[model samples]
Target: MTMEDKREPKRRNPAKTQARILDAAFELFSSQGYARTGMREVAERADVATSLVVRYFGTKAALFEQALVRAIYERGFFVRSKPNFGERMAALVVGDEEARIPAMMVLAIADLESREIAQKITRDVVLKSLADWLGPPDAQNRALHMLTLMNGFTIQTRHLRTGDVPPESVRWLARSLQAIVDEENAPVN
Candidate 1:
């Protein structure tokens, strides 16, 4: 009997494989954007067959949406209290490079459908949740303002390659965001 014949083939776990694929997809999409990221590249990064990626995700858009949603939820941005929301957001924008993925995705994707998906996720999931958490007295508008501030800051930091944001700058940004949350400095509407 040949020794090679006795070896057992590796078992496949669908759930783990899907998770790995999603993680790989998120990494690629975030770094390369949807237009530049390919399914084969995702499969390669996940260390799986390209056919498996297509079978699981169906299309690049579907995969992009799923990966983006998963990344957003994993961030847990909405779980924090409103009292220090500004400070938390400012810290994320200034210090957490990983936290900038959503904004990066939004700016980087050029394809119409993929761009729409990114925008929709940003508005529907992120904006809606933040507005809901803020609650009343122009919560929607305030949340929009907060998102704009954070997104703009994220882009600026990335483009300018600003390292180690000054403590005073962070504090200033925090105060500006906190003012929006507090609604004390909001203009009459």
Candidate 2:
């Protein structure tokens, strides 16, 4: 076959390329934190041109925000019944590696700009949405407490390498979380 006949056109799918870049950005940002991760590195990981990563995400802060949202909220942790909320959240804190990534990313990010983005998203979107889902009777305050507990548990379990949390511990945590979710125990204000 002639050289012209043998040549094949390059394939370009913006959606797939964007997704690959986002996944790479998520992995790197979660593992290395914001200041350490770079566009070139992300492009290398995603197997795309660095310019392409820039084109798709515009800025590192924007990329980080999107990656955080995709990693955290898209998991649908907030979509649950009140009765099983504690158990489900406890399980996530105990074993879900995916659930831990966003928390890790938030904790790891040292850059002020990136930290602000994380804080804004966590507060405006995640916290607000979770509080709304929880319903009233001090829902906002309870949601804050619940998130505090979960984030701490995730970081502690992940860093401590304390393998296999005891069933009793998990149960206690679940009950504690349930107390926050249930309006019966809310302090008289």
Candidate 3:
């Protein structure tokens, strides 16, 4: 095959290439922390040129922001998928290391502090969606409480990486969250 023909396979598909770059940035930022990671490292890991990474994302901060947005988006934090979702989410917090919620929390806390865009996404996309799923009249308050607990659980499992959290504790946490779900669905007096 001609060299030009061989090189043709590597041509960028805009969506796919962008996804790959985001995936690479997510992994690197999660593992290394955002400040420590660089655009070149993300490019190398994504197997794309640094220029391409910059071309798509402009700045390292923008890349990191997009990565964060993608992670939150993937969790479907606002969508009510099923009954007992709190239990399911709690189970996920315990079991799904690859979910990266814990790592994302660290990134927000450590690097993205004072970034209005990040705050806006968290407040608008995540918090609002979660509150909406819980439904009114106390939905926002309930969501805030649940998020606090959920984040705490994620930190314990993902960041602390402590030996298996006691199964009973997991069960209790799930049950607590389940109670909230039950309340949300309960008939009004």
Q: What TM-score do all the candidates reach, one by one?
A: 0.85, 0.84, 0.84
Top-lDDT structure, candidate number: 1
**lDDT (10s digit) by residue, model 1, range 71-186:** 88888787777688888888877765665565556555578888888888878888998888777788888889988877767666655655766788778889988888888445
Residue 188, model 2: Cα distance from true site in angstroms:
8.2
Q: What ranges in model 3 sit over 4 Å off?
A: 1-10, 112-117, 186-189
Off by over 4 Å in 2: 2-8, 160-164, 184-189
- Which model, 1 or 2, shows the larger TM-score? 1
Across 1-189, the per-residue lDDT of candidate 2 in tens digits comes to: 899988999889999888899899988887778888899999999999999999999999899888888776667777877786788778877775665555545555578888898788878988898899877887788888888887777666665656777788778879989888887455668
Q: What lDDT is reached at residue 95 by model 3? A: 70
Residue-wise lDDT of candidate 3 within 138-179, one digit each (tens)?
888887777777777777776786687888878877887777
Clashing pairs in 3: none
User: lDDT of all predictions, in order shown?
Assistant: 0.81, 0.80, 0.76
Top candidate by TM-score: 1
- lDDT for 165 in candidate 3 is 86
Candidate 1 runs further than 4 Å off: 1-4, 162-164, 184-189
Please say which candidate is ahead in lDDT: 1 or 3: 1
